[model samples]
Target: MPGAHGGSQLPLFSLTIMESVLDAIHARYAPVDARVAEILENIRRDCRALERESRNQGNERQVEEFIDRLRAEFGERVVIERQRLSAWAVRTTRWNYLFTVRGDSTDRIVLVAHYDTWRGPGADDNTTGEEIVKQYLLADLRAARRPALTHTYFLAGSEECGLVGLSSQLLLALGLQAANLALTQQNWLWAVVAAALAPLAGYRFGVSGSREYVKTLSTEQLRRIRGVVSVDSVGEGRLYIPRGTLGADFLHALIPFGDYDSINDLLEEAAHLHGIKYNNYLAGGTTDHVSFLEVNNGLWVRGREAARRVAARLARRPYTPPLRVPATALVAMLPGKASPLVFGGKIHTPRDTPDRVYPGPLRETLLILDYFFHRLDGGARVGEPRNLDEFHYARLYRTAAGHLLALKDAVEPNRRNVNGVYRATATVEGKRGIATVRDLVGWGVETRLRDQVAEICAQLGLTWERERIDELEVIGDDARLHFARHLTPFQRLAKASHRAIAAVQSVVRNWIFLTFFALAWVLAQVFGWALDVAFSLSTPFALWVAEHTVLTLIAVVAVEIAILLYMMARRIPTWIDNAYRHENRADNLGSLRRVRDQTLR
Candidate 1:
């Protein structure tokens, strides 16, 4: 058959031959078998003890021992390397074991699994993933002939707490500075603050590890990459594939990143072709495959720009764009269960022991991956890239609508108190009611909307400024008038209430200064009264004239100056707001066009 690479004929394998090979491998390493069970138990015991003691050193030593064993068994066929990562005041060491089966081509297929545990035995969370990698390597070694592709087995560390090990390696490979992945006290504080004030501030904290990981790959390497399959939590239940980093629609709506559409399609195709019963859906939670998807959809750059803009606004500084890296999509996954928001419920707890993992799913996962790898080795491409602008714009609009609906529900509870006003302001035809905080939020959901619109416009080869949208007549005066004119009496009451409160606050602030002037006038009167009584007794006309005329004029001038200063101080905030708005209004065409060109290509 025709192949994707240089029109070269692709290698095809019979189903019977593939199944026979996978069956032989599965029989020996099935989770219930004595040999495999023993290995898994040992891993669980070591990881559980080390995690309890908080000893990453022990974990490193354990991983090193595993690598040493592999080296001894495979001899020259397996190449091993150790990578030491330092980030966030912590140091970690991870290993990469490459199993070379010299092929006609130089393309590489990467299989990844993290060996570290969060807590408990972690038999299902990741011990299953590690064992799968080892079993696959063994099968590769025992094969009588060379395979069609080279395989790189990346056994990572520190994945439970953060994707530090994987992210650091990717960063260093692409010549970028590795970020601090440690969750510090300050990070936790900000997380709390962000959660508490999320409604009003509309800010999200931290960066995606997957996004950073993808950004650290060069263009050539990305092109050469056949696929990156992450094996995680496959010890129990059926084989499952998640759509992207965020498995659920709500989570994706809130913070959209990563795009695994192409990879997911490939995996499903493989399953169907092999007659493997597998579960595929928009599952919840994340795994290492996310790193690839984040770059595939171009959401990582969007996220980075959003964060940079928020920081620049807060710090009152100009935002300078960071370094750029080329991107692609070649990530897939192997996991257990088919839950919407979780993989294995026992994970991260003591219940996640080896006994909870079923042998059937483990065997099925291995089969699926074997089929996927072989298909990729045959020079199969993951199809054309998705239109990221269309994808993101649809999600943006949906999320905005969701937020408005939620706001409406919150206000509905208090409707009875304002029912009369609501009726009074109802439209003549009664099709629409009044404007609440929801209307305000919907109209002002500008940050992501503006960014997405700018991106879409740039992709169309049009020069667009953010403020230009607001200038359009359809959305300008007409929309505002329409919203105001049809407001239910309740909405008008709410709006009037807001204005009244603001006006009261303004008067109260001015009155504070006015009180000082009043106090000064009273003091002057008292002093003048005392001076008059004393001067009358002593017959001093000059002192009495100075107190009545010059002193009084000086006090009046001082009060007037104080009033002027207060008025100017009130305008200071407005000046700052206007300046910020103006800065953002600058045409974003250049940067957006470059991004569009780079990502779409």
Candidate 2:
């Protein structure tokens, strides 16, 4: 999964799921003599505890307790590491631990899960994620067969605070956890990140703010990454991920873990292959992986909402050809296939707890992610997501469940074929957005209006003919589909005017300049002013008003003139010159008039 690296669609955990993980780990403990929360109560009872344990340090006791509890639950399989940071905040020190099933190979892949949650008891946000990772760790040790890729494992504390523990101590602790100098010395550390931030590499990435969870391709250093798969809420409550988009290409299979859990959910699997079942994780909050996506230099896949925006604008079709839909909508649909689910609900209230989650169809989500990540990491090479039959087909497709029996093999999120219409076609299809295939076809058809835009550009004496947009126009049958071509000249003019307005409005009506205008108005109101300076007579009140108003107006104009002079310093003509020329051209055109009378008929 995505972790602090770029060149990926998703950045892993750039925000706040840390607290949730911590909360889950916290709940797993009874603190020896002190009963979990009771211990916290005791600690809080003491002022020294508050002083010595202030948020970070106090969390350490909780961390230690969690390590002990995990040890009890998973036995010697859990490796806990504690670091005392005396140099930083007063009593604050970070404790990070790595949990690996004994006999786990360094040659195998790594499962990176941060055990830190933010603020309070974050159950859905990440307690579930933390629990899944910890359970996976234990299950990894107890399982009769270790996963193909298992390079030890890890957990972090204080992830809520910029992933400092994960970034620093965890790397060292993994070595100590494995008890092998070579394990941490020269091993490839690949990961399957749960939570919103998935691993990044291909088109499927992460998103911020929205549930889609994509990362900037430009955010991380990509030398160490192998592959990534994340789960997030595809906007509009749909779930998706970008797999085979050529602009952001990907392998075509999701791993199959028979049972679903957060740890395995990101890899994408339709059914139980290898005892792993896909389960949908009830998610809330962000993940630590976001900081790691598109690790080099890239942006997230365009969002569905953004695509919808372009689609809405296309529906308007106010002259400018709405031919860009195919590309624009496709770009926006880039991140969903890999994301988990999202809901529009108020947060932090008591109503949000495990009891609120109903167990329905989440198994595929867990199965898919785990399978995708492992396979991408090397459980399987980049190819079609196959079933037990090796039939190379997708079984767990998104249909109204049980409705599909035969044709479910084709929609592997990564198998797209745009052979004809446009060689480079983008598709923005999500759960809800993908409801209509006809809509997609229509979008592709409407995208052909580039011809009109090219024509308009040519008429304007612009150098746009050789451009790609100029070379292509989506051609379709006019009988049933007549798309509007070319933007109206008035719209073109309004756009031009708006552009000019944005660029020059600052100077034209700046508050500082407007202050001068206001002063002019004040003078006019108080003493009476005239717009025409030459026509003013010698009435005392009018003379005073005119003098002050003109003086203020002149000063404002002079400032603008100074700004123009500054801009002209670069040897380019000032925009003021253009503004003046436009006005002059309008005046010249206005001066010539031919009056013609026509009959009403």
Highest lDDT model number: 1
Candidate 1 collision pairs: 247-283, 421-490, 422-490, 425-488, 425-489, 434-488
Could you tell me the lDDT of residue 432 within candidate 2?
13
Candidate whose TM-score is highest: 1
Q: Give per-residue CA lDDT, model 2, range 383-488, as digits (tens).
A: 2222212111111112211111111111222221000111112122321111111111111101112332233334444332211110111211221111112345
RMSD of each: 22.7, 23.4
TM-score, per-candidate, Cα-based: 0.43, 0.32
Cα-based lDDT for every prediction: 0.43, 0.30
What would the per-residue lDDT of candidate 1 be over residues 1-601, giving only the tens digit for each residue?
2111101111222321254443443344333244445555665676566655554456667677777887787777766655443353122323323344455566667677766665355676677777777766766677676557777666665555434433443433232111111134345545554444333222111123233334555766566667777788766544555432442112232353433444555565444333444433222345655555444334466677888889999999999754322211221223323221234446666566666665545544555575576666673322211111211111111221121111101011111000000001111223232222122221111222344343334444544332111111011111221111224577556655554544543343323334334544565576667756866787666565666877766775576555544443333322322321222222111111111112211
Cα shift from native, residue 502, model 1 (Å): 45
State residue 383's C-alpha deviation in candidate 1, in Å: 20
Error of 2 at 227 (Å): 4.6
Query: Going through the candidates in order, what is the number of backbone clashes in each?
Result: 6, 104
- Give the clash total for candidate 1: 6
Error of model 1, residue 493, in angstroms: 42
